[model samples]
Target: MTSPSSPSSSSDAEIVVVDLFAGAGGLSTGIAQACEALGGTLGEDVRLVAINHSEDAIATHEQNHPWAEHYHAKIEELHPPDVVDPGAVTLLAGGPSCTHHSNARGGKPIREQERASAWHVLHWIQQLRPEQLLIENVPEFRSWSRVIDGEATNDGAIYQQWIQTLQALGYTIIRDDRGRYGVTLRACDYGDPTSRRRLFVIGSRTHKPTAPEPTHSADPEDDLREYRTAATIIDWSDRGESIWARSRPLAKNTMQRIAEGIRRHCDDRLAPYADVVETLGPEDVEQLQDDVVPIDDLETAVKERTEPFLVTGEVAIADGGVTGEEPDPGAVLVMGQHSGAYPRDAQGRPVPTVTTTGAIHHIAVDAFVKPRNLPQRGVHSNATYDPGAQPAHTITARNHDGHLVSPYLIVYNGQSDAADVDEPLPTVRTKARHALIEPDLFPWGLDIRYRLLEPHETKQAQGFPADYEICGDTKRSVRKQIGNAVPVNLARALGAHILSWNTPSLSTFGGGVTADPETEIPAYAEVSSTDD
Candidate 1:
């Protein structure tokens, strides 16, 4: 894949942006990067006036962008015309409440609630009236109709109405070859690394046939760079297998085994949402539903096995020494292997592009259970692990029934002879298990061996700064934030291209503007750094 170019060097070359419905500032963040690439600062001449209804999302936006003024109330509460610095505003962008347009747009008997959200995009644009405007929504919005009677005719003709209003306001409409609303841009084509296709409406004072020529391309051999992959920003330095700087020690043997499995069992190393079920204990199954495990409890288990115990005989304990026979074959062995990967930090390669499925979480080898006595159970710990060359499956958000579908890595014993078991094997264990498991045997110990991605990981992958705090503490809220925000890197890439295409004359404006900054003016917003 082509490496991303360096940020623009001139501070005075900034471009200003105003964001409406700016949930968690994904679009703003991406625009910031683009400004940087074009040799400009996001806050100086290039500003981002962001607005969002969710307090939690706005809070996150403020923490990252202390300079930008944020409105935490509904879009209806504020008068955008009063807040904008007209002359300096390069872009006016809004992705209004699209839930209705996306989920219930064409459904029969449209409710009144649905109509309001779908029609609000243009309402906000009229108020902010920047030099340019862009609207993003699901591909389905192209054919969306406001329902009237039980049947679906053109219904309210939402698409036609939007186009007309934009034109009436002297805005030009640009459509991609696909004929979707605005422009049909494949995010991956711009080297986002993820296949997130979005419908964008870009208009400027001067009518243009298209939005902009794509700076990045999907086909490596067709003039554009190769598309990026999840590995690009994974930060695998300390963690052998990650794209980032953390380390989770995998057994040398285990790594080799996993590699073999990937080659033999998987059709592709980066299988998206390929499901694998490790024979989990009743407790793990419970933890999956509950969404948490006692960290202290799991950590203690790893501590005990730091050094393989002499399980053939009794060992001394601080409380007292106890003697014992070989461990029973029936006793399950839980191994705590190292599963470290990824050191999250914004300074690393820019995060992967963001997506609607950004809320999806992955399963990881957070903790493992290794029985203190392995020989008695005829199990041997793997000694040679190689993470750098190995990769786990890709993770996606859509659920399969109730199961959070994602990739899995499971390991089972190769020995299942009658001699190993004193009693006949249970019938249930025989039929259900990973193929890696020996016939008639259940997977006794499953480490992350390999696992799916997590929402936090997804956030990192999607170009949010590593430290970009996803506001709400609840999983559902976190998912919403992640899912809603645009990928900062992708936005930045596109922003930089716009600046390159339109090298407008520059002016100074780094400090807060006056009560009424001119419609076509530039000013800086001064800032003081804090150690905190």
Candidate 2:
């Protein structure tokens, strides 16, 4: 075992990263970016070498990150693990194949073939022994080692076995004593407009005794922390406004409803579509216009918008040319430069946290509950926003496709610059944005009524470069990629804390802080003896 003591002269040269189970390279990208943020020279000598069991995933990784050497075979296939030079590896990071530990698999016995294949990561870790290790997974993994009271411990039983193996290899352990890690995280915590939370574990063979600190918190009493909400990261379209930025796609049913609502509200004032034309700054409105073409008439435009929002399959919007009444829904609609709307629940606040389970159908704007009944009341979250602060929580893909399900965001509610209570939602500033919404009014009645997030838009919400691709065209593949990965920004901030030479203070919403310092307990805190 190595301690984080004085480094050899060679240590300053470079640091190599080996990404095992490198699904679409989200973790690797985050670590690489975080290293860059550390403010030092990094190059080929200290770079990423990613490996994954899926050939398609490897290809996807290759497409985006040509610098990294990718291995398409399973980790166990490494004859002496020939993926990369063993001695050059500085860190090993990834969340392994989570099927066995996932709740979705449900009490069914895992396929022996897949189970056998999954163990290869442990084999690789044992063989490589990189200086540092980072692992991420759902919270239930804490008990994957054993079936509790014969209830069938799919998550706990397997995790216990995995950790035991690591423990045997002389790795230290750190888990959330209160088990809060797996909850959603809003992206605004790290200067992002969305809120996304993830469960992370960082261990090192050579680094000092340190772990990642909470860069964001839901508590309010703590100083130096700001509450990040949907109002913070306005949609790239709504930049400069105070709302969580969003570019998420809405579900078909929800899209229909939204278009109907907007149309109804603006009906009497509905002018010719051309009359409201606006340009997206100096840039040719062509780019934004091409996303959705507006019809000359209002009813036609509603139908055009509904086609993409409601249909699960792709519907190409042709040339985005001005079409007459009774036009094809497949025709593309052009959108002029305009501020985007806030994804809200029935009461007109931001939507609640979305999950891959119903990826598309649950799109409702969630809001931090504030009583219109009493203006003096504090913020309230209906299973969304922080209980104490004003910002969103965190945004993550939380799906296998690497598509963003729910952007952990705070619902921003306030008087507009016009001092009007009912002003337009703030525009976002980030490049490439999409909004999420419920598929239809009766989603629970039919599971088939699901929402589909555009692949590119999903990547943007998860903090991937705008052009990044997940390497699969199928829904199952895409959703899986999004669900399996970590929130890159969240990981980056946490990594900074773990890698920092000094302790970092919390920065998200200070809603997690306890009012009584001596109490050592907060309202939402769930203290446990097993935190070590």
Candidate 3:
């Protein structure tokens, strides 16, 4: 086999990259794309070597990027090839498994074995001594504490020690003047549709690289470009074919519970409307039931009946009308507009944070109420009707619970209307289960149902090329791979920034150099054999 770091040609000035713990080649692909954008020939001027423990992930990576050298072995079993000079390697990049350090994993005691995985990156750094190293992981990794001899150290002792070790090894770790290592970047800030936040640490042997500037912005004025919404990237034509499009019938018990919740919501909203009726005299109440009195006229009658209760001296009712203490015998009733009971967002905005599991909420709309003339026999109006204009919530793995993953409630406006809605898709989670409510399915009632997102749709949401193949036998495995992988556009933006540091024109942004520190490394923080 060829050496991992061997150049394709002697004449090519290649930027050799090794991605440790590489997942499905996200970082590798980004780096290569960035290099190509900056005039470097991929596979020639930019060589990639990806290492991951999962045979499935490695298989997917190999299928997508056959040119890159791949190793399906644990990081502990890998070493630099003797044919390559460690100093000649241009860059080393990796994101060790962040499960142990992730905030989502909760504050479990730091596992010694898992914490040691981070040190593996250091081991490679010691061997390769690459010019630049980029480490990506959960933001919480910076605050990870060390457990030495079963005793906990300082809150950030582990991360601080890692930095000091690199500094001692003749490298400059990028940090703000305040000594904060790693910059947190949101994927949407770089124009990826998904909203994923990741922490990145850059260590350089020669010069410090500036963090990439935001190309897209949440605010209109601050960004060079508007944030890319999910609608722009997702293929609406194939939406019906998505796994999420098919109905996953809810359990009978679950459906009953949802119906009860809806009933309760309707009751709450109707309280004030019912109160107006209570204040009416028998004749007025009969008039209201017969539609002889307009709703406004009934409200006026109710107000007149309660006028004596008005604490305010003024008798004339304003637009909002009289609102005060009740009269002893006769008080005019006041009616307030019913508030919506659901959550929704406009289609133009970014989606909520995508997680391992997806999010589903009822589409907020005007609560359904029985017509004053109609008998209150059954639940007629549903608050779950879809407006067909709001974006999706965060995507997650499980969407089986109707109470938790309350699918968007859609009421058929007309029989001729299509089921399609022009709204942003939710963040794609590992399970990729999303749902829609079809009121048309049941006679004058809403039916909540589930569907799965196609693997390609999930990939598209993550800013992967439409043609990118996700190699996995099971849909669950494929969805998991897509959810865990970094958004390709985000990776490209970061890669471009790194490449900029090497280019003369782009290097002017920060000279690719860190300012000389006004102070020295503290004496107590000196690197030692035990620091590991």
Q: Which model scores highest in lDDT?
A: 3
> Per-residue lDDT of 1-532 in model 2, one digit per residue for the tens?
1112232233433777777778777677777777778774445445666777776678777878776666776666665345544545566777765555544343656543444443666676777676667777644454455444545444444545555566456554343445322232334455432344344555554433244444554455654355444323222221111111233332222222222222222222212211211111212222332343322232343333422211111112223233222122122222221112111111212211111111122223221111010112221111222112343222223321111111121112211011000111111111112232111111111111111224453454455676677778674565456445555666676555555533211211232323223322232222333322
Query: What's the residue-level lDDT of 374 in candidate 3?
Result: 9
Worst 10 residues of 1 by lDDT: 421-430
lDDT of 3 at 531: 25
| Model 1 accuracy (lDDT, Cα) | 0.41
In model 2, what is the error at residue 211, expressed in angstroms? Answer: 3.3
Model with the higher TM-score, candidate 1 or 3? 3
Query: For all the candidates, what are their Cα RMSDs to the real structure?
Result: 19.0, 16.0, 15.9
For candidate 3, the TM-score is 0.61
**Whole-model lDDT per candidate:** 0.41, 0.39, 0.49
- Residue-wise C-alpha lDDT for candidate 1, range 1-532, written one tens digit per residue: 1011232222352466777778877788887777766676555666667778887788878888886767776666665555553345677676665544442122435454654654565665665565666677655566556565543354435676666677666565565574433676655455443334566776655434245555454345778655444344333221111101113322333323333433333333212211222222333333333432222233343344332111111111111221122122122222212221112111211111101111122212211111111123322321111111111111112100010101123232221111111111111110111111111001111212222223454454445777888777665555566556555555765565554544221112123332213212222222343421
Q: What local lDDT does model 2 show for residue 305?
A: 43
For residues 1-532, could you state the per-residue lDDT of candidate 3 as single tens digits?
Answer: 1234443332355687788877766677788788889888767777777888877788988888887777787787776544235776788888887766755433455666876778888888898888888888878788767776654463877777777777667676666445577787777667666556677888776654568888876466784776665444433332121111223322332233233333333224323322332243333323322432222233353334422111101112223333232111112222221111112211221111101111122222221110100012222221221112222222222211011112222211101111112222343445544333221111001122223335665576567788888777887777777766766777888888875675222222333333335333321221223323
